[model samples]
Target: MTTTHATGTREEWLVARLKLLAVEKEFTRRGDELVQQRQALPWVRIDKAYRFDTEQGSVSLADLFRGRSQLLVYHFMFGPDYKAGCPSCSSIADGFDGIAVHLANHDVTLTAVSRAPLEKLLAYRQRMGWTFPWASSAGSDFNFDFNISFTEAQQRDGEVEYNYLRGRHAMDATPAPEPVVQFAANCGTDAQTYARDRPGMSAFVLEDGAVYHTYSTYARGVDGIWGMYQWLDRAPKGRNETGVWWKRHDEYARG
Candidate 1:
């Protein structure tokens, strides 16, 4: 049950606080509604044989999940053509990598997938100083089937966003998803690179060592886990908007 305010101010101070309680209850109700909507999303099966390159060696979709019943794979935005990944995506993945071990204990194996070749993925991972499992899906239709790869025509139809050279929203990029595609609709693109409509996060359930795609998400659907600012925003040096930077505690360690 929600708490209520008292009728007293400074002279009757308790009453004002009581009113604030009512407002809190309304907020709780709205929050519950939002959660319900999120849980209502439908699931899909991944019949394609998506292969990835890992540090240990090459692996198939089923092999990646180990023995866990649930697998959550993040489709990182590092394409084979690009030397570097999207900065925003890099920022989000930074946190994801660190949390992998913790999540594994709970029967949820989390990993990152990208279209970059094995060497490229390893190079970037080293440069970014990440330890989470990363795999390459290059030379596979996995990206296209998942709606993240762009076709030349889709780029012309305003379906992809690229971040190559000087990023700009243009129709010049090659291989983009058509407007009819529900995944990449209204996606902003940068001319230097063509945006694929397949950018997304996917969840899977493994029973008897076989994996079944249970849920997947893209765009804002991943907003919850990608940013550290949300938690920091509640702190004293809080941010009121995006673009605020955070300094690591270790970086500020003083001898």
Candidate 2:
């Protein structure tokens, strides 16, 4: 088949591959440095009592740790009004089941927290066939305090702050982006309700019987943990994106 991409002899390919290898190695080293910097950030002690509803019943934030000293919470975007979880968040979470076991054994409990009711979260989890821990922050300030979920008042007053930026998210746009509208409809809600809940991840540590917020990242900062994107980045065509081209796992048609 004729191809538009560059093609060359084996010798030329090897030369190019070797040069790319050097650049990849440097990128790896830079990523290592970032790891150190992330860990070095000051930990803020959480004094507010945040509770979550789990299969075990309502529990404190510390209980979500599952007796582990470290906790990693994926701020899933499943608002109370939505009929289903966000497609983007669902895509990111598709990888959780595979890694949850390894993370648990490593003394880190990975849990997903969302504003949706426990019943809703559990039903969706069953639909997705995910076994990872999921907790409900419905009627709780946990999601709001972590800055992952917002209220109608906050959205109306333009007080929503996300990814360390104020009033700049595409989801918060006046007319709502096409992707946001599409995703919102897929979740059985409107764009405004869907955008109120943003996706992110947060890390916490239990020290001296107290919990401290270690770090949190939002928006593209979460790309590192979205397993599919990592593989796509290494693929021949890379992301090869025009727009929102993915759906929830079960929504995809089988060949």
Candidate 3:
């Protein structure tokens, strides 16, 4: 049983909606300004020749641009020890393959970077049936350098640096929370193993034959790319979340 809202007459509803429309318009305009601000940020040159294991074999970070001037890497939470990707990250990736072609045509190459071994990544990619390019950062410092994946020692030190902050992660709890434990079990790993890996996205630009890191964002910053959340956010009831209520796309029960 849910509570109901007050009923309004047509005239009253119209007046209220018009007022809300003004606010919506202001929000959209602010969003446009933020986009420009992001573009204006400083770009850092990447000197290290970071290599990744891709379907096309070992390739440098610049190679990921794939002839495009820009590259976007979704830092997926699939660490070396986890048997599968984090469910939340998987949910966001579910929408990627659909938009990848459009991005490629627009001179932007969007891909997923994970710390899992190439074999594991390929197997899961096959299971998910995603055609978008995914590369492995295994045996590389790409994930660490980007500030997403953390080492066990970092976790034990009670200062897991993530989302641009150095602090104790929730997964650092001795037993962790029930949801974290369950998600780890789903990934065929323990809570600590799952908690150590965090999600993030990074942007790079290829200019004058050099790779420059343009931007990086984590946590809620990625909400916009999680297709399901974008839609759910617009629904009347909103996200309506209480706890971990999502799984890998195929894990849902079929009608």
Candidate 4:
């Protein structure tokens, strides 16, 4: 078949591949350094009592660790008004169940936290057939404090800060993007309600009977862990995305 992409002899391809390998190795080394820097960030002691509702019942933030010394919380975007979890977050979470056990064995508890009620979260988890832990922060300041959830007042005043930036998300635009509207409708809510919640992750450590927030990342800062994206990035087409082209795993048409 004819192609627009560059074509080359085996020898030429090998030359390019070797050069790319060198760059990839450098990138890998840089990523390692960044990981160390991330771990070096100062941790803020968590004093305010934050609670979450889980299958086990209402539990303190510290309890979410499940006896682990480190806690990793994925701030899922399932708002109280949504009929189901956000499809994008659901896609990201499709990889969690496989990794949660490995994380637990490594002294880390991996869980998802959302603003949706516990019942809603549990029902959705059942539908997805996920075994990883999920906790609801409904009526709690956990999401807001992490800057992944915004208040109506904050939205009204254009004070929504995300990914360490203020008033910059495409969702905050006057005419919401078509993908945002589509995702919101898919979740059974309007764009504004859907945008009220955002996606991110946070890390915490339990030390000397106190929990400390170590790091939190929002927006694309989370791309590194979105499993599907990592694989797509290595594929021949390399994402090749024109627009929103994903759905909850089950929503895809089966052959």
Clash list (residue pairs), candidate 3? none
Q: Per-prediction TM-score, please?
A: 0.68, 0.98, 0.96, 0.98
Clashes of each: 25, 0, 0, 0
* lDDT per residue as tens, model 2, 42-85: 99999998888999999999999999999999999999999999
What TM-score does model 2 achieve against the real structure?
A: 0.98
Deviation (Å) of 12 in candidate 4: 1.0
Q: Which ranges of candidate 4 are over 4 A from the true structure?
A: none
TM-score of 1: 0.68
In model 4, where is the ten-residue run with the lowest total lDDT?
165-174
* Candidate 2 RMSD computed on C-alpha atoms after optimal superposition onto the true structure: 0.9
TM-score of 4: 0.98
Q: Give the whole-model CA lDDT for all candidates, comma-separated.
A: 0.65, 0.94, 0.91, 0.93
What is the per-residue lDDT of model 1 for residues 1-255, given as tens digits with 9 covering 90 to 100?
654633344755667657978988998999899778855765465677777788878788887786777888888877666656655566678787668888899998998888878898788778778888888888777766666566656555665443322232433334423431211221133433535433468788777555666666766677767676567655755655543233322233588
Which tens-of-lDDT digit does each residue in 66-181 have in candidate 3? 99999999999898889888899999999898899999999999999999998899899999998899999888899988889888889899777777788786667887999889
